[model samples]
Target chain A: MNDHELDIILKKSLQPDVSVDDTLFNEKEELKNMKPMWIIKPAIALVACAAIVFSVFTFNNNANVTTNNSSQSTDTTNAFALKVKAVGKQVIELKKDVSIASRYGEVGAWGGGENDDNNYETDYYETFPIACEGNNIDKITYSINNGSFQIINVKGDGFVVDGEKVAPLDKGGILPKSCSDRGITNMEDMLAENYEEGYYSSFTVDPDFQESEDVIVNICDNLTVDEETYRKIWCFSVGPYKDKDISKLSKEENIKMLELVKEGMNDVLSNVVINCTVTYRDGTTESKEIGVTKIVVTPEEAKTLEGFKNKKVKVPSLYTAYKAL
Target chain B: MNKVEFEDMIKQYGVDLLRFCRMYLYSKEDGDDLYQDMLLTLWKKRDKIDYDANVKSYALSVAIRIAKNRRRTWSIRSRIAPESSYEQMLDSGTQIKLQDSKAKQSSDPEDIYVNQEQIIMVRNAANELPNKYRAVIYLYYSADLSIKEIASCLKLPENTVKTRLSRGRALLKERLEAMYYE
Candidate 1:
């Protein structure tokens, strides 16, 4: 078709029919009558800010009360930070070094009680075996190749010779030494510029905030109430979720509540009133709120303790089993 | 803008916006729905828009943006359910009309009949154009937007818009000729 003919036809086809019904008129009218964003935007932001502040205040206030109650009680020893590593004493019985033949002597198969006409009895040993080892006292001792001696009192019942009750295996004595182990041996190795390494914890920003960067993870260790113990917590700093973005969520309030829950758990883990302070690469420090629940040390946590008594001791291969001295 | 002013703006530019959308999109229903959505968007963003600026151009730009976004969403949806997208576009019997009219033709037909068929073919051909070319064509011809204005609206280089327009015209001509001869 020529340009003139095409143009005329296009105009004719493109134009809406004058008689066409406006089915969408009501919808359009509703939209037109809708409040302008200038008013709604700030209103929504204010509501969101009020919501966040209210939530943070209420949540932190409740958390502070819980912390104070837990701390004031004279039983701080039982009060583990939510899920701190709990290591307890386990007493494993030492197995006796006795052989089957020594215990049973000679077994006679199909032997009669007193006498049998055609006896199927067979004697394995010419004489009955006596007790193999001497009836010694309840003291167990081991000398490496008959050199230096190591003694463990069998009847001591997990008590040291001084009569002090000691845990069979104590984790408190085993301090953390590696970053992953919750100990920062070297600050240089533990601090990461990007999300690649430093502990990546998660924290929600102000409901009205927008994040330019991703959430950064940092590993933080604070000395616990027990001077010897360092409470290890992961600090996560996430970019803000803007009000508009939050509004896009199906349940913005629910998400905000979830963020509050995260904050609550982080508060319990870090034991901080607000955000925990984190040191950056350039020695500049910033406070980043904790985002995730603290890591709990299970009873099955690998034993990190090295020596028993100035001597390198090999722990038993099995978790609950004990290695005899 | 007050409610009356907003309603008036919609009545004035709504038809032109719908035309741009219809020529730009494959489905008239999709275009119609998109037109309503564009009006809603304009109403919401009315505060940000400068009253001194050209309202028609702004509406055209908004229409184009909405069309682009809808196409993007459709493309993603089509990948997930290709048959559903095809059914949606062709469910209105436009494809059937195009197919039926393809073989039956006359060396010469009545003026009204020829005009009617040409209009259908033109709409179909414009719809069949690639999204980039279709967008440029609609803005240039239907919206009467300058090449520079189209580039600004689509956030593309002026030279890119010009190239697309030339390619789009050539393609549209080919589609029309194919309908006529074949």
Candidate 2:
């Protein structure tokens, strides 16, 4: 085809009446539009933030293939600016009775349930099935092993006797921690940055307004408001989702994914209802000014949280659940 | 520099942009829809725009980018639309063949002999060309852009732009000669 011929033909193909100005840019709306922020822990202390619209985290053992429930990581990296870490107390009880080959009726050194290697590093702990009998309470003495030692009473009722009650564990529960628990030993040394390391007794994002770079986790305490229940609350922000990206969700997608995650978290939170609000640029607000609603967390997640499973803890009150947006 | 400049910019480039729009997107409705959207985006981004930069270039760039994106969307929609009606036979049907016989029917009575048949044959031949060549030819004639300008607007290298134009021209020449020159 000659250039001129092609030009004339192409030109005519474009009907003169056709208007060309109506292009829409929906690039801002991506598939992972409404999801919570999550991280894939690579190692201890090297905690890094990864952002993905949709991602899967899985592990397998032998022929048992399991597809993990997928989740979206939507947290703003800048929101977790405060780098802090916390060391929570966890009492790992090996449910099965462990023992040695029964050498000489002497119950030779080989039989025990506890891993002694871990004993040297506990923030606070005690040995059991030992030589001491009757008292259940053995003579308490301590060593800091790698770090310093501070005695803490693990009440038989399961509360950490640290001047006040924290989230209590059952007969055997790993000590709970959050981004707020890194203040026990030395707030100065522990709080070197956001996501610090150590135990903290409480949380209330100090200087909260300064766009927190800190994410503190405590191994020995519970952030769940009421100390009576002994249940821990883990709170993290997916995003400041107040702007256009989330608002763009066509009332349907936002709601669908929100229901999914809320369902997933239900097992852990037990009837935890998420209250949500959206603030638009027009000075208009979509708030619980919308209304309060219940979200049934998933059954699998409910199993992970002892509190969620218990007949006791009050139903969770969270306004941050994804809306039908 | 505010609404007036934006409105003025639209008025000046609006017709040319409309011509550019018609080349790829078939429907008049779709083209105008895109044109409005482009104007709004220009107005929205007005403050960030380099006031000294060529508004025509910027608007054309935005239009092309938007057009490509819209084409992707339309392709998806087209695939999903009813298999028959959405394929745009209005442009491809025998009307264009009939149009092939009628020359530019200008009322000037100047007897310039602008055979509408020649124009229709030319249009069909161009439309039948590969999308790349069709686009280059569209930009060259309909958009009145230089090779370098087309390259910058489409984010292609100048050589590629020239190549597309030359190749597109060659194809059109071959097709038109085969169909009409005979």
Chain B superposition TM-score per model? 0.69, 0.73
Please give fnat for model 1: 0.10
Off by over 4 Å in 2: A1-325, B79-128
Angstrom error at residue A300, model 2 = 30
Worst 10 residues of 2 chain A by lDDT: A102-111
Candidate 2 docking band = incorrect
* Residue A164 error, candidate 2, Å: 39
RMSD of each: 28.8, 23.7
lDDT, candidate 1, residue A208? 15
Best by TM-score: 1
TM-score, every prediction: 0.36, 0.35
lDDT per residue (tens digit) for residues A28-90 in model 1: 565544321110000012122222111000000011111223213443232111110111211
lDDT of 1 by residue, B114-143 (tens): 344555677678766766687788887766
| Superposed Cα RMSD, model 2 | 23.7
Tens digits of lDDT, candidate 2, B1-182: 46667666666766667666655454344555555556656766878776566677677788766665334234323322322422332433321223222343533333223234555456566655777777677677666778877887777999998898888777777776687547
